[model samples]
Target: MKKQIRFILTSVSILLSMFCGLENSYSLEENVKIEECSDLNCVRSHIDEINKGIVLLLAKRMQYVVQAGEIKLKNNIVTAYDKKRAELVVNNAEEFAKEKGLPSGFTKEIFQVIVDKSRDFEQIKMDKKSNLDKIKTKK
Candidate 1:
């Protein structure tokens, strides 16, 4: 229950931050009248800003992923990969993509990469914990 609540809260915070950041960027661009992007350089500049924002959001998401891995390790969860959770995540991403007029396949592929990396990180955390325990037991 606690884990579920924590997960939900983390998810909510992520969504909130994404939307807030998007809102700010949208408004800023609107103020600058850069949405039209008449020239190649202007379009490239806008793309650069978008990429930067995406990278920032991904960094924030990974921070939460580390926290989640720690929580799972402390709670004695055995595996980093949760099939049901992964499916739910993909499904949610697909739905969001539909709402935003993005390609479902593109969204699914992107999320699969994110989920795979998250699992790798979680496994690393679990492995580190296991190693520490083995060392402690030896002494």
Candidate 2:
């Protein structure tokens, strides 16, 4: 069972490293550097880097959400919040967190916040596009 879990994690890590498309972003092990932590200051620095990385990832994700909003508008989808998809995302994050020995509920909460904000950003993008269309039509 341990081997299986390790294998799954390895596969996912490889895939993410290859396809995540974030330049200069380190993997989990590289980002943490537990062995190199000689003092509290070193640990704090690592934490800061990890936090910055999280923000960068969130920004990148929002960029895609913005594009998705535009595509939704073009295709006449008319809805920013897809309940099913949001649930799936949170569930998946929870499961992954469990596999990584993290608190599943905490992971679920974090993902829920992300999804809510993403929905809001998506809605805002759609509204701006709609307003632009209205202005264009009036001209």
Candidate 3:
């Protein structure tokens, strides 16, 4: 499990690094090696890089969710939010957060936002596909 997590994180870091088109950006290793955060700007800089990576990773994740929308449409699920699936993700994240010594509530809240965005994205894709199909049928 630890190996799997490490591999996944590494993959995501590579994908985020590429997607950000940040060939000129400071190397992540150099940026993360803060000896000490003595200044506000120092901490903010780290936060900025971390947030940028998170944003790119989330965008890629959303792409998968859009693909899931196609499958849901084909299966007649017709809803983006599968309660069981959402619960599974939340529960896993909550436990992982606890294991990592982070605040469970904060982690859960973040996961909730992610799940909400995923559901909305999927719905958007589903709607677009439906419209395209309608147009083809009409023609």
Candidate achieving the largest lDDT: 2
Scored by Cα lDDT, where does model 2 land? 0.69
Model 2, poorest ten-residue lDDT window?
18-27
Tell me the spans in candidate 2 whose CA falls farther than 4 Å from its real position. Answer: 1-34
lDDT (Cα, tens digit) per residue for candidate 3, span 1-139 = 3453344445444443443334344433434333345676865565566667776887798889988999988887777889999988978987875654444475576677678768877988898898898899999
- lDDT of all predictions: 0.65, 0.69, 0.67
Q: Pick the candidate with the highest TM-score.
A: 2
> lDDT tens digits, residues 12-114, model 2?
4443433223324433343532334567686556555555666678789999999999999989987899999999999998897666545338667667777
User: Candidate 1: lDDT of 64?
Assistant: 85
Which pairs in model 1 have colliding backbones? Answer: none
Q: How does residue 45 of candidate 3 score in lDDT?
A: 68
- Candidate 3 off by > 4 Å: 1-35
* TM-score, every prediction: 0.71, 0.75, 0.70
When sorted by lDDT, best at the front, the candidate numbers are 2, 3, 1
Model 1 residue 138 CA deviation (Å) reads: 3.3
lDDT (Cα, tens digit) per residue for candidate 1, span 1-139: 3453344345434443343345443332234333654676875565556556766887798888878877887898857888899889988987876665443475676677778777887789778887898899999
Superposed by TM-score, candidate 2 places the C-alpha of residue 28 at a distance from the truth, in angstroms, of 4.3
Candidate 2 clashes between residue pairs 3 or more apart in a chain or in different chains: none
